[model samples]
Target: MTTQEVANRYIELEKQGRWDLIQEELYSDDIVSIEPDSAAAMGMAKTVKGIDAVKAKGKAFNEGVEEMHGGYCTEPIVGGNFFSVAMGMDVTMKGAGRMKMDEICVFEVKDGKIVKEEFFF
Candidate 1:
């Protein structure tokens, strides 16, 4: 798949909240995930390497949420092998109270798989 194809499929799965499927189908084995430094305060690593670790990180995040009120993922803007999307969510965390968070997520595609993803809030 081309980067545009990957981006479209990502948006499709994202709209359905099918994160597991997105990762399973689109991520490269050696994928890298990067979070902002401030994420460390929320018990998230600044960087995660490998698809397994990334999946674990996503699982941990989902586990931390007490309730998901709503969320949105914007259509991706593709350029070269990179695509970017704006995503936001309103959720209640296990220990933290309900809050709304928004972020810009950028993904790099190579060989029809997402090789890197970085988030900025």
Candidate 2:
């Protein structure tokens, strides 16, 4: 699949709350996720290898969000085996209140599977 296809697939999976879909479709057997600095997760970029780890991370993210809305794809900058997804994510929390964070999510695809993923928010 093309970079646009890869990017679009992620957006779709996220919207549908299918972390498993992202694991099976976009990610390879081993995947690494680089969390953002401002993110609640520790480490700016931690390599969470394998599908289970990725899924756990996804669940954790979902649980953290008190109310999440206003998600969109602003722009997709595609390249060979990679796509830079510019997005807007509105997250409301019990304590922090509502905020919209512009993010750049990068996917590393090999043979149509995302081997590594990272986000800068």
Candidate 3:
């Protein structure tokens, strides 16, 4: 699949609360995900290395996101095997109501699976 397609699939998996969907289909064993600093996640963005680490990151995000409303993607661009996207999330942050967070994600797909994921805010 194309890079934009890979990135969109990740969003879809998270929306469905199907983190397993990503692990089983899209991820690389050495996947690395960079998480940005936000109210829910404090400190500078950090990278989670390996498949296990990536799953932990997803759970960490889920801990903060009690509910998801709706969202969209824009500026989806691809170069080489990497797809980058600018996305916004309309989410309920745990006890907080709705909040919007702008994020940029770069996904590297190899052999039809995502080998890397890096995000920024």
Candidate 4:
């Protein structure tokens, strides 16, 4: 799959809310995930390396959520091996109150798999 193909599939799965499938199918084994520095206060590392670590991070995040009200992922804009999308979610956290979180996510694809992902809020 080309970068465009991967981006399209990502958007498709994102719309379906199949995040597990997205990681399982589209992420490279050595994928790297980067979060903003402020995420450290939320108990998230600034950078997570490898697919397993990334999966664990996602699992932890989902576990921390009390309730999910809604979420959205905009259409991806692909350039070279990179694609970006604006994503947002409205959710209630376990300890924190309900909030709306919005971020721009950029993904880098190599060999038809996502090699890296970085988020900015």
Q: What is the TM-score of each candidate against the true structure?
A: 0.99, 0.78, 0.72, 0.99
Q: Write the per-residue lDDT of candidate 3 for residues 1-121, one digit (tens) a residue.
A: 7666776787777667576987987898887776655623553337678998777777777787888887767755778898887878799987767888788878889877898777777
Model 2 residue runs over 4 Å out of place are 2-4, 11-19, 40-45
Model 1 stretches astray by more than 4 angstroms: none
Every candidate's lDDT? 0.97, 0.75, 0.76, 0.97
RMSD of 3: 3.4
Give the alpha carbon lDDT tens digit for every residue of 1-121 in model 4: 9999999999999888899999999999999999999999999999999999999999999999999999889999999999999999999999899999999999999999999999998
Lowest lDDT 10-residue stretch of candidate 1: 12-21
> Whole-model lDDT for model 1 versus the true structure?
0.97
The CA lDDT at 78 in model 3 is 78
Clashing pairs in 1: none
Better structure of 3 and 4 per TM-score:
4
Record all residue pairs in model 4 with backbone atoms less than 3 Å apart, i.e. clashing: none
Native-referenced Cα lDDT, model 4: 0.97
